[model samples]
Target: MDFFHGQDSLSILEWTLRAAVTFIFVIFTVKIMGQRAISQLRLLDFVIALMLGNIIAHPLSDQRIGLKGSVVATIVIIVLYLIGVFLSLKWPRLRKAINSTPFPLIKEGEILYKGLKRARLSIDDLLAELRKEKIEDVKKVALALWESDGEISFFLDPQFEAITPSFYQLQTEPFDLPQTIIREGRIDLSVLRKIGKEEEWLTHTLRSLHHTEVNNILLATIDSQNNMKVFLYV
Candidate 1:
């Protein structure tokens, strides 16, 4: 019994070592792979991620397999991934084979049933995604595309879109972008400096507006027109 217990304790220690090594190896691999490897993953990248999870998990729990084997397997997977990325960048045909192209879900205020069927998306799912974008009526949409990454991009009809000064043939003066001076009860010194305004000036301005405490302000902005907008916390 003592011999078995000693073996189990040694197994536990081995497992810990395996987990730690695999954890560090995965982190290093992700860093080398770059952000797009995880984020904005295409179908091929998604499959690889799933397979890699299974590959890493097996050695992590199994004490009989050596950590060196897991490390080697991981490195091999990363190398193949890098090679695939290079090929995808160089060859458009190969890229198309690995990742799906965007499909039109709607065009000219009309739902494309054929496109929806090809994407394997139901009307309810499409409507839910549209609602998330605050689009309730389908007629208001001029074009909607189901992106390769499974996101829906909406383009409103010209009539429904917000009218800009350009529509009226107006010559608008170029202005500086608005800078946030305060956000979430905190003063942004970088934004203050960017707007060429000093901290003392802000304090004085706030005081002039009967705002004695900066923390009391929830949000503040200085627009290109030199208009200072302040919203206080309730």
Candidate 2:
């Protein structure tokens, strides 16, 4: 007799139901935990999230680990989490150790090579991020930081004058979206009616931008100046 011979036979229906339940629980739990997703996650936060995922996935995939196992794992994680939270509160040094500090990437218009190396970032990557921030020139950057949460922040040189382009050149300003009036492809129909534009106008505008369907847009906004901005997922 084999120890593995008695493994539970999983049907497609069982798997599907388990997957759905796992997904819903994860989504709901994350919502309750607040919105520190991915790019905004600290190391400890990421680790906790990873453990939660594992806890949620185990009973869903493994027949041996039933709902009881999932509940036990969740309780253990919650207790550990509470302990961590209490410790972080009681000891500031422990909190600091858990949450690493942000590293400075640039200082006084020069790359802090030591910090950059520690951050595993190259000068070219710094330049690319600077350019993404609509800074056409690197000399304008006074300071930059690779934040602990993995977000990049930059400070500009106040004394350094912006480079002046020659006459007759049409310099394009960087694109920025306004405050969201509509979200998740849904028009705030109240605002639309108040602004004297119907759904037809929205459809037309999106069509102009090569978006034929409203579902294609991830976010849509209209500024106080009445300029509309639309964003789509790739």
Candidate 3:
């Protein structure tokens, strides 16, 4: 079946060329707009991207590009951008009057409820970002700023620590797990050598506990207190 229905249809080659041109145009247009397309996007940047995407899409699918349609749209977007930039520079008071600044959500380990209210952020929203950094208690957070781009910047206390799990109270630090020296009745000789210990030291330690063979041990660890914890099968 002929899809074009006798209309002057574009050959595959023509379609490929048109698609390539459109792709390049869109990429170049986006590049000209700066890195705001990905990072630190404000309300105006978002609106322009949406409108530009729509304008670019319409021409690709539509059968006709009228004499003045695309040119008019491009000119309008450029004009608006230039006007915004010009006005922002020429009149600082006007710019500040229009675009609001970032509000402080927290300061010195205290939540600014009034600022949160003004920023339209709930306690839950604030807590969620805190939780992302595995911070259960907000008391350890020194300062948290709500950026103008709607991102939360966290400044944690240097001495902040997470609450340890019940079974792992000795594990005060996250990456402080002790290396196993003995497991399932076998001596981890490699571990012993890595820690600068020898078979004689292991044997002497075992002799003190009335055991000579590693096979009798079920679990052994160098605890955080710098003590060897040996659990033997009874």
Candidate 4:
């Protein structure tokens, strides 16, 4: 009893051994489960991970439970996880039931309130995701799907998408994509250099626009068309 309560050599060694074994087991299990198990975890995979964490923690903290029992428990979890993966692959209905279907957040630039409610997401949340995709207006999106992994995939309307030179049967020189040179009043020197521009050139341009300081600019970018767009602080 005293040995279990105290931080003695035997107790330390036992805890260390338990943690090592548990870590190795978890690593191998994850390796066998493949990248999808950790990257794009579905509901069943998420639940199994949570349960496995608790099961592993029990033996690590409890001095009474031995390593053999912990190993057996972990193996059982792995087997169940494999079975779940098999079922999900073999049966479409079971897969849909386990992972759920992608929710249609936006269609034809219209927000689906019912889908938002079902996904437990608010209008603001969807707006934030849209902003992350560089979309200023939802009207530009033809379709938006809320994936099971909680990621929003956007499909832009053909009218809102950029037209290629080939569409007009015109030959154009190769150009680099637009990169932000300044964001929120901070000058990105690396981006400036990447675009074949210098700090001196940027400063001169700002002077021409009646702007003296880089800190006074809110946003600035140069497009493939060699056009410099600038937004000043209000």
Candidate 5:
């Protein structure tokens, strides 16, 4: 059975086998590449993505192209990509070259037209980005940087910033993440136990405070204070 190096005319079963093996190979390759490879597409990452797509796609579409050759080429490319990533981490110059340093788009509430040109962003693009950040006035921005990941980081001027608890040195309780006890009209016994509460306790609390059955509640959560909140299905 010709599986990897397909014949001139491939059988449907052979084609299916090739596709399945390719799919599994792609999945494992993606797994090998950590989260950053998926999330952030830097220069190196972009090159790797393009190369892999082109290499894998040709063999799958054309029976004349051997599947085994594509797989071998992909393996070599992946190895080279890993080496580039490792070298980028060790060398600052290479790192900067691969993922360029942040360019200052705005300073002291003034837009840098040269920065915009260098970043290859038009005035309309800048305006659209500002609108997305909900800043009506450019003067309100103290600094705005064009990051390597094609995202802009904005900093509001001190006068335009909101007053926070830290500004007044106010005391605040530690933030507590509420644990889910019930979801989709089903009670989670493990979560209930983790919160140090019994199933009977949950039943009794729901019946007394909310006057609702466990099955009727769509979602429920409890905080550190044992304060249970319930949401019923609409």
Candidate 6:
């Protein structure tokens, strides 16, 4: 209770309690902020993350700083952040201002010097970004843009693009993601039902074809064609 307000002196247990309470409070605050806060650090998200961290961090280190004030400040900051996000969505200009427009770094293998200067990215940095994408030759790039999230997006020229079956006018079968029917020796009944198969059928098939028991299997998946792929535990 003392930790909630300003504390003059504290024991080890009080400090520990403060840490645990602060940790849970921060987690709860972040949960309300949603996945976007952690997954992407756009301008608005960056500001929210920075403020929340600083506000909550002060109370953990200093006994004079109260958890009560920090918690209230965090709530207020999060509400403002959410409001900012909503307003940005409603207004296009605000969105553009918060998350600036992408800068064109390269176009048809030609470097845009003006854009590089505007984005404050050096030639070496651009080269390093290109190298990270496994693009050694700048001439092969059709377009490259500096994204708002400080990441580079590169597109290879049509002629330099990787060959796919479609390029050869070849017909490819439709893709169906394989569903995991069994994992760690446990049958996923929901998946079995989704695939229109019964546990008895899966058991019999494994015994007849793989000569293995369900308990010995570590993982298994079924494709659209009823093709069962099984991997036994090592």
lDDT of 3 by residue, 1-234 (tens): 232234455544444444344444553565454332334665445545766677667777886754244445655665565676688779978565434465678887899998787666789988988999887888888888776556778887877744448546564555557878889987888888777888788768877865556788888887554468788888
Would you give me the overall lDDT of model 2?
0.67
Clashing residue pairs, candidate 3? none
The number of residue pairs in model 4 that clash at the backbone is 0
Candidate 1 vs candidate 5, lDDT winner: 5
TM-scores for all candidates? 0.68, 0.54, 0.46, 0.54, 0.77, 0.70
- Evaluate all candidate structures by whole-model CA lDDT and list the values in order: 0.73, 0.67, 0.66, 0.74, 0.79, 0.79
Report each candidate's C-alpha RMSD, comma-separated, in the order given. Answer: 8.7, 11.8, 13.3, 10.1, 8.3, 8.7
The 10-residue segment of model 5 with minimum total lDDT is 30-39
Model 3: lowest-lDDT 10 consecutive positions:
1-10
In candidate 4, stretches whose alpha carbon ends up further than 4 angstroms from where it belongs are: 1-40, 165-234
TM-score of 2: 0.54
Instruction: Report the C-alpha lDDT of model 4 over 1-234, residue by residue, as the tens digit.
Output: 332344423444454454445544554565445333454666656656766788779878998866664566566667667886898899999777666678788999999999887667789888988999999999999999878665778999999988988889999878667778889989998888777888888889888875567888888888866577888888
Candidate 1 residue pairs in backbone clash: none
Clashes of 5: 0
Predicted candidate 5 versus true structure: per-residue lDDT over 1-234, tens digit per residue: 477883565655565555456544654565345223443556656666766898889988987777765676677667667877899899999887667688899999899999987777788888899999999999999999988767789999999998989999999899999988999889999997787889899899999999999999888999999998999999
**Looking at candidate 3, what is the lDDT of residue 154?**
86
Candidate 1: where is the Cα deviation over 4 Å? 1-40, 52-65, 173-175, 183-197, 224-226
- Between prediction 3 and prediction 5, which has the larger lDDT? 5
Once superposed on the true structure, which residue ranges of model 6 sit more than 4 Å away at CA?
1-40, 113-128, 165-171
lDDT of 3 at 13: 45
Predicted model with the maximum TM-score: 5
